[model samples]
Target: MAGRGEKTVRAVRRPEVRLPQLAAYDGGELEAEGDYDGLEFADADWAGQSARGARFMDCAVRRCALDETVLGRARFIDSVLSGVRGVGTDLSQASLRDVEVSDARLGGTQLHGAVLERVVVRGGKIDFPNLRQAKLRDVAFEGCVLVEADFAGAVLERVTFDDCTLTRVDFSEARMTDVDLRGAAALDIARGIDRLSGAVISPAQLLDLAPVFAAQIGVRVE
Candidate 1:
């Protein structure tokens, strides 16, 4: 659990099989071996429903709304989404294992090519979340806010952004290995930052992003 550039964390990749417990559901299409365990979707709405390839285990969605829900390739395990709002939600290529999105409110959420293993976005409020080409493994964004989220060409493994609230979040052409933005709340107000090669910030978040790493290599930090 060292600081900057520390690698060697790539776990969460569960769900090899097991998932056979059906019953309880008030929404629409969620076929493909449907098995929503311990179901209890409260305040359900499921607008524009279409949960493709469904298979949610230990489900428990409260204050559910799922606005414009499509959930392509759905397959959440040990789920638990509270205060779910999901505006313009698509969840493209979804898989989210061990999910636990609390106080959710995903705005313009699409999650392009999603997979997010061992997810845990607490007190969420994700805005403009695209997560292009997503695959984020062992994810964990506690007390989230993630505004302008994109994660272009994403693949970030062992992700972890604790004190979240990354303003202009957007990792252009991302591929960060053991990504861990040191409990970010201001990684220089997050943007592209040269794609944050193999991210793992710490050490005071690299001295508070050192003026955005000297204006992206131009090095004129006067």
Candidate 2:
């Protein structure tokens, strides 16, 4: 386990998604247990739709609106979601593997109990993301802004936050392994300051979080 101030030396494995020719999807409403493969969903409005247990593979969803959409237990493999905007989008228990989510603007997104592996989220702003009890492995967040993200009880392994800003993130009961927070632009933890045994942060971050650490251990610094 690396110390709080020490940086994790392990390099995170990033995803390399190579897409093929995609067919345009002409579906009107989302169907439950729908199977979408190699499809391109451009500028589709999926507001207030339910796609429970759907499977999406080798697909691209660009500029889509997902407001109040339910995607519970959905599986997304080798897919890309770019410029997607949403509010109150429910993705509970969803599985994302080798996926790229870029330039997204989401609010109140529910991802509790989700499984994400080899996923990259780049250049996005996410607010109030609920990732409680989720398992994340080999995931990277680059140049993103997360506001009030709840990561309580999540398991993170080999996760990297590169140039990402995390504001008021809750990591209570979350277990981490080789989770690198060294490259984060700004990190503010709302809870669980003592659960950083396996995770690593830069010296500047350590200094920035010193007050929280001191409060956790009942130490007062003048």
Candidate 3:
């Protein structure tokens, strides 16, 4: 049985963002390095844009097109990205707090060395996302498709993947504690099965993953 893990993800606090709308958007393009606060950037087209060190507080970016955009060192607090399309976007070294990304498509996005706290990714297709060396605390991915996503060397605490598709996902050298994968669709098809030492899964999942685990230990089941 996958016993209770040593370190579950700590409870994340809500983002302290109380931004009053100061001005309205003039429909002009945003500067990449600007600090936007309390803005409602709904349905904005940010495709292929570069926003380095941008701080978004109490922002609502709904139905925005962030395809191939670069958002390195960005900070998102109390932001909700609903129906946003960010295919192949680069979000390296970003910090997310109390961010809810729902129904978004962030396929092939790069999140290397990013920090996520109390982030909820719901009903999204985030396949092939690069989360190498990232730190995730109290993060949950619900009803998402995470096929072929890479989490190598990442530190995950109290992370939960609920009702998601996790085929071919790589977690090599990752430090996981209290990571609940029992609600995943398929865990046998994932790579690096032996590296998930401290993760918690259901009893039925262990039976399904037995063949993969046996192969990792060079045991040929005849």
What are the per-model C-alpha RMSD values against the true structure? Answer: 12.5, 1.6, 2.7
- Model 3 agreement with the true structure over 1-222: per-residue lDDT tens digits: 245544443343433434566455556765677788877877878887888888988888788898888898899988877898978888999999888888988778889999999898889788788999999988888898887988998998878888898878888888987678877876645666867766777779889888888888999999
What are the TM-scores, per candidate, against the unseen true structure? Answer: 0.34, 0.96, 0.89
Where does candidate 2 have its weakest 10-residue lDDT segment? 1-10
lDDT, candidate 2, 34-151, per-residue tens: 9989999999999999999999999999999999999999999999999999999999999999999999999999999999999999998999999999999999999999998898
- Residue pair clashes in candidate 3: 9-157, 9-158
lDDT agreement with native, every candidate:
0.75, 0.93, 0.81
**Candidate 3: worst-modelled 10 consecutive residues by lDDT:** 8-17
Off by over 4 Å in 1: 1-7, 13-17, 24-57, 60-65, 68-77, 80-97, 100-117, 120-137, 140-147, 150-157, 160-177, 180-212, 216-218
The CA lDDT at 26 in model 3 is: 57
* Candidate 2: pairs in clash: none
Tell me the spans in candidate 3 whose CA falls farther than 4 Å from its real position.
Answer: 4-24
Model 3 TM-score (2 dp) = 0.89
Candidate that scores best on lDDT: 2
Ranking of all candidate structures by their lDDT, best first: 2, 3, 1
Best by TM-score: 2
Q: What is the Cα-based lDDT of residue 203 in candidate 3?
A: 77
Compute the lDDT of residue 147 as modeled in candidate 3: 74
